[model samples]
Target: MSQRVIAPKSRGFLFLDSHPGGCRRLVEEMWRAVPDPAPAGGEGPVALVIGSSAGYGLAATIAGLARVGIRGIGVCFEKAPGRRTGTAGWYRTAATARLAREHGRDMVFLNGDAFGDAVKEQVAGLLTERFGGKLDFLVYSVAAPRRTDPETGTVHSSVLRPIGSPHTTKTLVFDEHGAPEVKEITTAPAEGDDIEQTVAVMGGADWERWVTFLDGRSLLAEGFTTAALSYIGSPLTAAIYRQGTIGAAKSHLEATARTLDERLAKTLGGRAVTSVNAAAVTQSSTAIPGIALYAGLLRGVLGDAMVAPVGQLTQLWDRLTGARPLDPDDEGRVRLDTWELDPAVRKAVAERWSGATSGTVAELADLDWFGDEVRRLYGFSVPGIDYGAAVETDVPWPSAGA
Candidate 1:
C-alpha cells in the first residue's frame, strides 16, 4: 500500500492533498462557470501564459482553451514529484493538461523560473517549432517572493510592509487545528532600499522583458494582445496593501502596461493592458497582513458578485475577443474589481471592519467560507475527494517531452 500522508499545517494554514482530484474539481468549476463560447469565426489563436500553473494564470489558460478553443503554453515554477508532497500547482497543471487533451485542445506546461532568459528562449523555440511561430495572447501572472536579476545577478526579495510608518491592523492567523483567530498585528515600514527591492521582485521589469524578448524574436502575431494582472483594494487596505511595498510594485506594473501599449501599437500593431483584478484567496494573498480579514469581509459584502480568479479571467476573455466591449477605467485599464469596490459593498466592509474583534469575527465576516477558499488554494477542503485514501505523489509533468 502507498504511504498515507495527511495535511501539513504551518503558520495557521493547512496544506493538504497528495492527489489530483481537488485540482480536477477546480478545472471542472471553471468550465461549468464560464459561459459558452460564441464562435470567433476564424482559426483559434495560440496563447503563451507565464505563471500559469495556478491562480489567475491557471484560470486564464483553462478558460482560453476550454471556452475559446485556444492552444496554450504555460510557464510556471512548481516542484517536481519528489519525496515531499508535490506542490498543488503540479497536480493542477497535470489535471488541466489532461482536460485539454480530452477536448482535443493543446495545452503544454513548462515548469521553470519564468524570470530567467533561458525559459523565454525555450518558449520561443516551442512557438517556432510547434505553434506556428506566433502567439495571439500573452498573459503574465507571476507572484514570487524573490527574484534574481537575470542580467545583474543581484537577488531581490519582496516584503509586505507599510511605506512610511508602522501600521497596526486586525490580522488573521490559524492554529495547527485549523481554527481561525484574529489578532491585532503591527507591520513596520519599509527600510532602506526595501521598496526598490520589492519593486524589482514584483514589478514589471520582467514582464516588459518577456514582451521585448517575444517581440524581438517576432513571436508575437499581428495585432497580438497581452495583459498582466494588478490589484487596487479598498481604503481599508490602503495602508498595508495599496500604499505599501506591494502597491509600489503594482504601480510600476500598471505603468509598464502603458509603455507596452504604445510599444506594441507602434511596433507590431498590437495592444497591451493591465487588468485590475478582484481579491480572492490565492497562495500569495494569504501571506499579506490583514488580507485574510479583508477578503472574508469583502466576500460577506459582495456575496455572489465577488468574482474569483476564474470569473475574473472569464470576463477578461469576453472583453478581449470583442464578445463585449472593453470598459476600462480612466487609466485605460480594465477594472475587474469594480463590483467589489461598489459603494454599497465598500460601505458594508468598512462598517464590519470597525466592529470586528476576535470574538465577533465569525459573525462579522465570512470566515468559514474564506478559510475554505484558502484551503482550496492548496487543493484541500474540496468536496468528493477522499482525504483518508492513500495518494500517490509521483505524477508526471503535464507536458513531458513536449
Candidate 2:
C-alpha cells in the first residue's frame, strides 16, 4: 500500500485495513444461524442462483444447501469481484461443488452471461440432464454493470447518477480512507431503451425469461419459487438509488415480480419474492459512485449488528425453508434488514455523524473491522493462506482478487 493510501483522510484516520480472521468469524456466525441441512442427499432439491459466487448471492446458495437441504447448481458470471479474473465465479464454485458432492449433495456450476438466450438455454439443459430438469427455487442476484444484447450486440452500461440535474456527492476510493471527500457525479436520465436495457440486465427480464424457459421444459416443480433481489433505500439515497438508471431497472424488477408471482402461483403453485436487502460493503456497492462514502461513514456510526449482509441471507434461507415469517403487506417491498434499520439504530448513527470532528476519527478506527472484512472477502487474509505462495493465475485464483 502507498503512503498516501495509508495516510489519514481529512478526519485523520488510517484506511481500515484487511482482516481475514474477522471475515471468517462473520461467515461462521452467519452459518450458525442457518438451521443445519435437513437432508440434501435426497434425489435433488435444486436451486439455481444466478450470481452465486460472491457477496450475499453466494451466501444465499450456501444457506440453501448447507442449511436448508437443497442440492443445487449456482450460475455465476464469476469474475472475481473488485478485480477481473480469467475464470469466473463458477471456477471457485467448482471446488465448492466438489465438496458438496463428497457429502452426497450435488452442486453444478455454469459460468456465462445470463443475458444471452444461448446461456439461458444452457442452464435449462444443465437442469434437464443433471437433475431431472426440475428445480424448487430460483434466486436472481446478478450484479453486472453492463450487458450486451445478444441480437444487437449493443453493450448497455448502467450508472447511478441524478436524472435531471447535476448532482455532487462524497465517495471514498478503494484503499483510500475514512471520510468521503466531495466528488461531483452526473448521469443522463434513462431513455426509453435505456430503461428497457436496464430492465433486461438488472431487472426481472432475465429472471422471468429463466423461469419461462424452465417452466416450458417442465423443469420447475410445484411449490416452486423464484426470487429477485432489489434495493429501495432512504430519501438520502433517493437521487442515486430511486431515480438513477439502476432504479429504473429496479422499477421493472418490482413490477415484474408481481407478474411473475402470479404466473408462478398459477403454473407451479409457486411465488415470486423480491427482497430489498439492507446495504453493506460489497463489490457492487463499492463501485456505485457515492455508495462507498455512505458505507464508510455508516460503518463508523453503526454497531456491528447493523451490518446486515449475513442476516439478510439467513432471512432468505428461512423463507425458502417454510419457516413462519412476520407478515409483509402487499407492496412486496419487504425489508430484510429491518432489524438493522430500527428506529434506535438509525437515530444513533445519525447522532454519531452529527458529533464527529475532523482529525479525530476514533469512530472510523473502530469500524475498521468492516473494512477488514471486505478485504478478507477476496481471500486476502484467510488463516493459513500464504500470500507469498506462487499463485497459479493460469488456473483460477482460488479466491477472488482482493
Which candidate wins on TM-score?
A: 1
Q: For all the candidates, what are their Cα RMSDs to the real structure?
A: 2.1, 6.0
Q: Judged by lDDT against the true structure, how good is candidate 1?
A: 0.83
**Candidate 2 displacement at residue 253 in angstroms:** 0.4
Q: Which stretches of candidate 1 lie over 4 Å from their true place?
A: 1-5, 14-18, 37-43, 176-178, 400-402
lDDT of 1 by residue, 161-278 (tens): 9999999998877766666678889999999999999999889999999999988998999888889988898898889898999999999998898899998899888888888898
- Model 2 scores what on Cα lDDT? 0.63
Write down the worst ten-residue block by lDDT for model 2: 1-10
lDDT, residue 68, candidate 2: 65
Task: Give the clash count for each candidate.
Answer: 1, 2
